[model samples]
Target: MEESSALPRISAVDLFCGAGGLTHGLVRSGITVRAGIDVDPACRYPYEANNSAEFIEKDVNELSAADLRPHFPDGDISLLAGCAPCQPFSTYSRAGRSKKRGLDWQLVNSFGGLIRDLQPTLVTMENVPQLADHPVFQEFLSTLAGYAVTWSIVECSKLGIPQTRRRLVLLASKLGHEGLAMPEALGSRRTVRQTIAKLPPLEAGQQYAADPLHIASSLSETNLRRIRASKPGGTWRDWDPELLAECHRKATGTTYPSVYGRMEWDAPAPTMTTQCFGYGNGRFGHPEQDRAISLREAAMIQTFPRRYKFVKNGDPVRFNTLGRLIGNAVPVRLGEVIGKTLIAHVSASRGATGAGSGNAQNTLF
Candidate 1:
């Protein structure tokens, strides 16, 4: 197929950008991200290093319209995109606490506040699906009085993400009445084996020789023994009686088989979490390898391009930091789908009238 002409010159500011996954996808789909803001300083190096965008290390709450005014000065099709921290709405959060406080939830509301104040032409937010039911979500929708809003709980795999993750996506526009819908499911879901089966074999705690990004975390001797007993697509029940954890001996542990489990090569992988690099975290083990998935593998499964850089030379490689960046990001492919949908909507709107209607298309895939 012949390459299309240069994409539209629209600019965007990504809030709460974790290592630029969504930004990367938007760029690939032809949107120019001018700057990215996140509280985590670690995000600065990787995000700025990888994308053609500036990175701001500042808390969203501390920001005001003036701080963002320069980025959207043209008032043309300026876009605001964010994926706030989802711990507050996560099912994994501990249930029933007397003191109900969530800074993350506040941060999302602040994101809404930014939208209300900045009044960007296009706005998009992605979060864990449960957020769709939160009262705060309703308030967020209400806050966008002039903008047309559309949202959905979408399966990431349906958008070609190669994992079973799901998220709630909201897109609102200031120009006309339209809503953004999920993109059409791509071909058969990409499988775990299809994603990483071809990499050179490495031992349980080994890093690849040629590629630094191909490094895998080391496994403890006890974990190594446990991995040896683990079976692909099987649970701890497959292990010898002596190898079982004390927790597993209890009734509650029986249902947690997805943990310390190997992936099935033929199926899509389980949702990649912040601790996915650890062997005992979840079903993060390699399909056939005796090790948990590597950082590169995790990024790839998160739909980051193989060439995407995550660290600078001489920087310490911290598993927690890297994992959080990978797990918390909007999958690059999903961002592309959102980007394309927005582009098509803008194009159609611009064609219908000489004005750029900021509305998003509502055609569900």
Candidate 2:
């Protein structure tokens, strides 16, 4: 690690970089993301191709300090960002068992392990807000002994995300300065209308030719019929009694009518989930389109750039794969906010010590 006096070059090594959402945001914030690590091979093409960052198809637990050091050779001001698989913490999971199933909670501990081993200048993590109250989170925070830590449960809409998603973000730095707070909201929240209404109309399961971003996921015939009966922001109650599922006739099913509903044009979208492309799943219907939101629409609400490419020519585009990637991503806008906060902390530390050496061109929106 070189010890030049210049404001340290901010470089990041992203862990569990699903489809490069956080990496994209970090790049937008002017931070150089040298590499991204994820276990899913499906992430390899998009993560590397879209972000111009090296993609390592490896599990976080298999990563060694030696493997990561190469990406941060200078080690001036390195960032370790991880948003581990969230199935264990997700409210949508049907498994009532412990987090040991395919969705292991221990993965979050691995992130903590990496932070301890690398001792990077900064660390950031994003996950479902419920994680903030989890025991693992408490342990991870307690482990950051010398570092200043600041965190918040932020509503995605407040940060200009077009979905009503909430996530827990934690930022920490080894410098004595307190961790930086998230940026204030830019303006009033963006609604579904503001985000996607301008796009050309498409029937259920249709794709637009002019804009690849206008692609919509197809629906099953039954689901299509169900969607037609569904109202924006309304529930299964709006359906004909004959259309209701046996489960819906039960008290428990009736309690959660928001499922299989439509988004209100004027309101933020429901939280994007791994199943968001399925019209039968959650409130994923387009306000007026009578179909599930498209892959492009889901990406947009997740704060991805409209033109961000997800696949190369001729590559298969499966809804399950893309939906999982979009739902599991750290919204790019939120990533920018985190990146800017880190830059400010690092720059302020360098300035106070009169050791500024690197150019301060990094901008956080």
Candidate 3:
């Protein structure tokens, strides 16, 4: 480690970068996020608008190292950052989810190929903790043994995100570093109330006229009674017998109690999923409101800024489209921690090198 050598500045390209969640965090940490690449056309507007990074709409499987090289310089501390879409491993989608012909199953391999070809200075990936046991994840790891790598299953609540999501975060460097420093925990967890208390409230299935994105899906009459019976953090077991779903009334349905429940105002919300805007989806119902958590609230829980516009100028905000983009994003706080860790690691390495050089020169004299 030579003190005379300057630390390399980081530049990154985010693959599977839906709505620029990771990019925003990297940018905030002062990394030059060159671009965000995703296959979803719905992601372009928000990714471009909220972050200074370019949005590249393309399938990562189809991307070549040649396609990615032009975005980064010939030589620098370039980072290939990605959070490959994680639906196949998701518990919610497990009912009928199959790996056969699923595009997501192929992405980890594609990510490996890109790394093999580009050989970027560093790599970082985040995904469901379940990925560690999957063969695709093992294959991805096999490609990185030449580099210093470390990964852990992290509790998102510890990282200041207002949700109880867990993820597998991995970092690797070819620059003589072996692993990343884990992000420190906040003094206290942020709650759903802390994240969305100030936003204007909305009625069921109503849009806040002033801010269209601050909207909630409507509840059916039966759902209305069910929600009314729902105590904060309580499940359908608390509902009146008349309102219980047929499945719930059966002996077999006792284990699925988190559905049709309400989030507690003082606790972190449950993981935001693609259908989080629906009343019957998981525990998405609002703590105090008579409706499900709105899109804006859901985004805020994911730690997206309040003003992040998910829709284009004339586009309508559809649940499935925006929900997928939002739910699939890496939490911005986690990204910031990752970005800052890289910076600190590079800086420390430079300082250590500089001190070694001074000692060597003294020895020579």
> Which ten contiguous residues of candidate 1 have the minimum total lDDT?
92-101
Q: For every model in order, what is the number of clashing pairs?
A: 0, 4, 7
Q: Candidate 1: what lDDT? A: 0.78
Give one digit per residue, the lDDT tens place, for model 3 in 1-365.
63546455578999988888888877766577889988777788999988777898888888999999987875557899988766667755521112232577788889999998999988899899999988898899988867888888989898789999999999888866632566647558999999999998788999987777888998899999999999999999898799999999788999888999999999999999878898898999999999999999999998888988888665688877777777777888778777766766666655632221011111100
lDDT per residue, candidate 1, 292-337, as tens digits? 9998899999988877888887666777778878877789888877
- Candidate 2 regions with alpha-carbon error over 4 angstroms: 1-6, 91-103, 210-213, 352-365
Q: Candidate 2, residues 180-214: lDDT per residue as tens digits?
A: 77865767888999887877888886877755546
* Descending-lDDT candidate ranking: 3, 2, 1
TM-score of 2: 0.89
- Candidate 3: what lDDT? 0.81
Worst 10 residues of 3 by lDDT: 356-365
TM-score preference between candidates 2 and 3, better one:
3
Most accurate candidate by lDDT: 3
Residue 256 in candidate 2, Cα distance off native in Å: 1.5
| TM-score to true structure, per model | 0.89, 0.89, 0.90
CA lDDT, every prediction?
A: 0.78, 0.79, 0.81
